[model samples]
Target: MSQQLILVLNCGSSSLKGAVLDNASGDVLLSCLGEKLGLPDAYITFKFNGEKNKVQLSSNPNHTGAVEALMEELKKHGFDSSIAAIGHRVVSGGETYSESILIDEAVIAGIEKCIPLAPLHNPANLLGIRAAQEIFKGLPNVAVFDTAFHQTMPEHAYMYAVPQELYKQHGLRRYGFHGTSYRYVADEAARFLGKDKNSLRMVIAHLGNGASISAIAEGVSKDTSMGLTPLEGLVMGTRSGDIDPAVFGFLADNAGLSVSEATDLLNKKSGLLGLSGLSSDCRAIEEGALEGHPGAKLALEVFVYRLAKYVGSMAVAAGGLDVLAFTGGIGENSDIIRSKVLDYVSFLGFTEDKEANTKARFGNAGVITTADSKAIAVVIPTNEELMIAQDTARLSGL
Candidate 1:
């Protein structure tokens, strides 16, 4: 196969993650992350050919600076000239983009219009796009939306039970996040089952620092847990999953908090951190719980309960669940959490194989259900970067 390279950029609020992949094989040739982008001690880490290296910047680096540094590093490794196209992960496509498209001036503008919806993400995404454009002049660029895969959701599922005008005028409805991860894992799960994707009813739970669950029926997104933003989904590292809308007003009245403050609190200071009052990491909470810490125990219980509840809800949305697969950081690594949650969903006729469940970790994919279980449970690691690269290659005609 020809060694066509596809560069993927995933610019988050605080980090810029880039990977150079062999477009034909979807194999990552080089991967790097620019961390603490806006901080004084910003730095970058690169991994290539099984070797990891780090470089500390002398001063704070913005998105453009990060991209520039990454390009320079790739050039040193002689991978720059192999690049055929660049793929950017834009968080919101709103009502416009349902699939990856070649990034042009109009597409950039469309992404810009979504700034109000993904205020924290789109701008940062734009910064990366502009930076890559300058560095890789004339390279075909593509915008792969995080919300694109979920665009298949029916109106009843994405619509909020509010005034119609709110949705019509402000787009105030559920535009699920993590569509990229969900898309990759859904297809992978189908392949693992040796069945056609379009014939399966699957509920995928992507549990990570930021988490969301997706319900896919007939190879289309039927419903998802996330809403107008990622904060509306399952409990995350620091995010509160589901909450009463009235709590915002209540917090303002009694806690002297503004809407923005309340929003930040839920997105950054709640979840496992608030519940455990020890740490936001599941591993840390697991350790604390083992030590008989009540808060940590409660947090773990809450997280598992919420995950089980959403799995049940998604099964309902898909009419019935044939495959229940877990992916993402916690889902891939934490066997205990998966086992506990599966216990709650036993009514679905899923029986967990304790040994297999404990062994699936670090990108190792396997089935964790009893041979005769009615419902199949498996662990499939997600590869959003490969999905982005594939979309970029396809749309760019590489």
Candidate 2:
């Protein structure tokens, strides 16, 4: 008998990442990401049985087109019949969903209600769901929310200081992002230390294009950096992480910018991109900094400083950190970023082994801290696809 498989789909605004995982063993059999969707260079690169392959579409493919192309690719590999269910990564579940659930009409309605909150993500997520449902008829589908893990945060941590009516009427609060990544890495960090997740106080820093940090005590999220939307967290690649609310009014009055214009500026044109006046990528920024590019050097400094500050704050939220973890693109790959962050927080008795950190990139996991350090620092690669697949399998009983 063939092994059962779970298809996990994570759709961003412009990208769709799909993976086929063994439902019993949770090993990824195939993985792919269709990037540059709706553009001239829209193409897909997938791995089948550990072999990498690329498919460039002659015509620009939307979400539906992308899904159809992937299905065709899977049929070519002769594994299309092995799929048991589909799992989707929905960005915002609001206060409705605290765990992964089977997708149905009501669940689709619930996801649609969150489109106002996750303008860029939820629509694309819904597109993936609708397309998958259409193409894979009769298969069970599950929705795993990215904000679900952080729903454990207390009222004080999630509540904003704005008018109480705003939250009551509009559901305005700190609904953290990257919950799936944090949950995966936090568990991975606990396992790496040979400790139970429920016994450790951990600070998980998920640094990527959209960065956020969470304070977890006893495996439950206590507080997180992102609030309301992903736009309110630590400095991201293009999003302005945190700023005074008055900046909006100031920009309106001084620069003659409207609310939407200001929102676009902050969400699309700020952060390292704005500060460096160059690329938003940390690797490029780091390279530019080494070359004495003033803007790039300043951006790198600001990013490291903000990360260290947030990690220190998270430690307080965790009631004294037992472990510090780095995940996501920047966190897992950029050795310089990790070393700089550890140095800034060395006051907490966290010392990093430079050599160990250098080798922890590209799917490698390791302990990067000294033996005598007060807190353990780990570099754990996150696997949200595996998490989503597990949730799908358990919920579907596949």
Candidate 3:
């Protein structure tokens, strides 16, 4: 096969995350696009294929603008401009896709049409693809949906008790997110454990700013936390995890708040920040709580409680976990979360080597579980971008 360059674009509701990777060597030729468009002082950073030199470009460019700027910068940075294809991290696939797909005008429209299903994210994801189509004209584009892997979810798991008409007309249903992250970590965890991906019954906690746990059976997503939107899952940086649907009605009737207002409050001002009244960062919360900050202490407790509950729930979903894996910012880096989560699952066969967990630096991935434990726990740093690049390369025949 000829050398192929695959670029992955990850667009958030308000910002851009992207990378250009070499397929054969598994090297990142470019690793930037963090520009928060319309927000000055925002910057883009890159660690170019192991070069000691790191590059930064400042100016908070939003998703669309940032994507174009990155394309321009690629040539200027002396990158090989012949990209074989582009891969996009689309958040919702609705019922349209069961796997990674080569992008077409019709496919793009289908993805865009699902915006209502993932109002907060799919649109921004669409923006990135729209920009890529215009900037990288003639190049093949692939969309690897965050909900794609979960499409394997059984109907009973994804179906709501709501009227069938609502789903048929508005696509109202559970479409789990963070699939790319789970997929990468699951495969890597199996490789690290010297087991085949399809052979393990593992519980994967993709804890980060947005957190979710997946029950992986035979290498496919059997169950996941995030549903419809990221807010439906485990407690996260700013989004409320699972909540009673009646709360919306109660608040609307008595609190004088509209549904939209309530939604914003939950998605942007809740979670760790709401609970702590401090920063949303777990590190800050852990440090503050340890020092006797009341709100922080409560916040940390709640966070851990929610995580423990879900981890245990997923263990049941997987029919009991043989291995438990943690990935994402908090999952891979927060020793405190690891300790707390493991402690909660001790009854369900989780083991932890405190010294090993605290010292592990996670990019290359390793086992954080102890030798004597029945259930092996690991910290596998996620690389959704690499997975996207690989998928795009495969689909594009590069």
What TM-score against the true fold does each predicted structure earn? 0.97, 0.95, 0.92
What lDDT would candidate 1 get against the real structure? Answer: 0.92
Q: How far off is model 2, as Cα RMSD?
A: 1.8
- Model 1, 1-398: lDDT tens per residue? 34689999999877999999998788888899999988878888999889988877655377777887888888998888889999999999998999989999999999999998999999999989998999899999999999999899999999999999999999999999999998999999999889999999999999998999999999999999999998997888999989999999999999999999999999999999999999999999999999999999999999999999999999999989999999999999999899999999999999999999989998899999999999999999999999999999998887
Candidate 1 deviant stretches above 4 angstroms: none
Show the lowest summed lDDT stretch of 10 residues, model 1: 56-65
Per model, state how many residue pairs clash: 0, 0, 5
Who wins the lDDT comparison?
1
The per-residue C-alpha lDDT of model 3 at residue 327 equals 91
**2 versus 3: better lDDT goes to:** 2
Candidate lDDT values, in order? 0.92, 0.90, 0.83
Superposition TM-score, candidate 2 onto the true structure: 0.95
The total of clashing pairs for model 3 equals: 5
Top candidate on TM-score is 1
- Candidate no. 3 TM-score: 0.92
